[model samples]
Target: MLEIGGVSVEDHLWGGRIMVDLPLACWVILLLEYLDTFRLEVELIWPAKWGLVKLLYVLDRFLPFVILPFVGFYNITANPSSDFCRILFAIPCMGIIACIFIAEAILYLRVFALSGRSRTILVVILINGIVVVATCCALLARYIALATWDIPRPPGVSGCKGTFTDGKLVMIGYGTTLYSGILVAVLCVYFGIRLYWSRRPGRIITIFYRDGTMYFIALSVMSITNVVIAANLPTGFRFLMAPFQGVLTSSLSIRMVLRLRQGAREDMGLTTVKVPDIEFTPETSGIAMDVPRTRLGA
Candidate 1:
């Protein structure tokens, strides 16, 4: 039996040798709840897009919650062997993977909309998704194989298997994570350069100041966190995935809220086109008129 934070892994057995923790189950539920809340808000304000994309995001946000609990309960009641438990766990893991891809899709769409460019962003997202999916599949397959073959469980846990030991899976996951991090960095640099080059003399402020920098920064931070988690891939990494996913989803929902609020402000004629200390030049061709500020209420 293994212990983590006073929780015992004694009773649980998977594949005739591995033990699963109750805390991990609880953590998954909490993450699902957070994602559900965020998804509800996003659904209310999701931008008009192709029908299939909309459908996918809706399913991505809701399906995990619906599926995970059933699998968890089934595993708990059945007390299945490690092989069976690993198979059951694959369901939720795949669901989470789907959600991550959905998030990447949303980000790609938003970038395309903002830049008015097509195909490039879509291709990038597609490539990233393929890599991520392939990596996850390899990981799941290896895990199942190991459990079925009765490989010795990692030390300190009777029946717990290491999910990140597969080198191909590790490389794939880390590659995607690193790619995301680099993409975010590039975007930030591009925006910063745009902001600098567009400075106009004498003009204190311009509507371009309202670009959604907060949203960009939030995404960048989340991407960096994902990279870190992927790089580490420690035994506890899975536990951190849910919370980071929740935060990322929440940030996206917040951006949606800000967009709606900006629209309302425009309708009410409360949006000033000028700011006292900012300026814009003709070179600022692609700057958004609705730049989201930290103090949006002001």
Candidate 2:
């Protein structure tokens, strides 16, 4: 049994091929949704908060769209030289790593802020994040190194075809999946409880609650789908769903920051989420005059 993408080459010869265009369509829709949101992001959010985290946030916005075309193009093109293959593979690989970590960072910051910036909570989350990222990186490196250079071309397929060289890459893939899934799931629960009990929701918190929940659920489903498909399906079918993973995670990451900033600008009382400043009117006597201030009260 000869396998180029973990599927027996015999399967390709027998006319077995998964519908790769489905994921392409999925990504196209996701990218369109992302682009629709981009204008609001630039106008309402990008101006005020410019930092490393924000940079990551922006990258998360655009990386999935960038990656989708590359992956799709590679799928249709003819086989390339070994060096070219490595370069082609490296682009999406690096994008995936960046997206995961950047999205994770944005999430950690959200949780940290929501937790009232507790040092202990931040430390614990950071420690766990570091371990997950490091382990997954090592696993991915090994998977790529061990991958077969030539991916078998399926019958009737117009373009190049390939997948991970080793099945063990599925382990690393889902490891990262579970890591992000658990973290987002926890945030969803924590905030759900918070949103449930609070009598009055701050504007930013309300936006966070709605968007975060949606993001959490969508990403969780995608990650689980990735795991199930990669582990149990034929190898050709496995890689087809890969690109959509970043779509929501990236969209939500950027949307989180944008919504937060939008909330802050629209609601004067909610500025403390990112930056906190307290203002006081001149005091005539012993008492401070009317002061405009914002603080985390809940």
lDDT tens string, model 1, 1-298? 5543233444334322211243345446546655655543443335333355456556555555564453334334432455555655566556555555565555444444334454675576577667666776666556446533233433444322333343345345535644663564465356445544555411111222233344455555655665566466543343344334533543353344334433444433343432211112224333234433423334
Residues 81-180 of candidate 2 have per-residue lDDT tens digits of: 5556666666766676667567767767666666655688678888878787777777666766765556555454344444455455765666576666
TM-scores across all candidates?
Answer: 0.54, 0.74
Model 1 Cα shift for residue 171 (angstroms): 6.9
- For each candidate, what is the lDDT? 0.45, 0.61
Candidate 2, TM-score vs. the true structure?
Answer: 0.74
Off by over 4 Å in 2: 1-27, 150-166, 191-199, 269-298
Model 2 lDDT, full chain set: 0.61
Report the backbone clash tally of model 2. Answer: 1
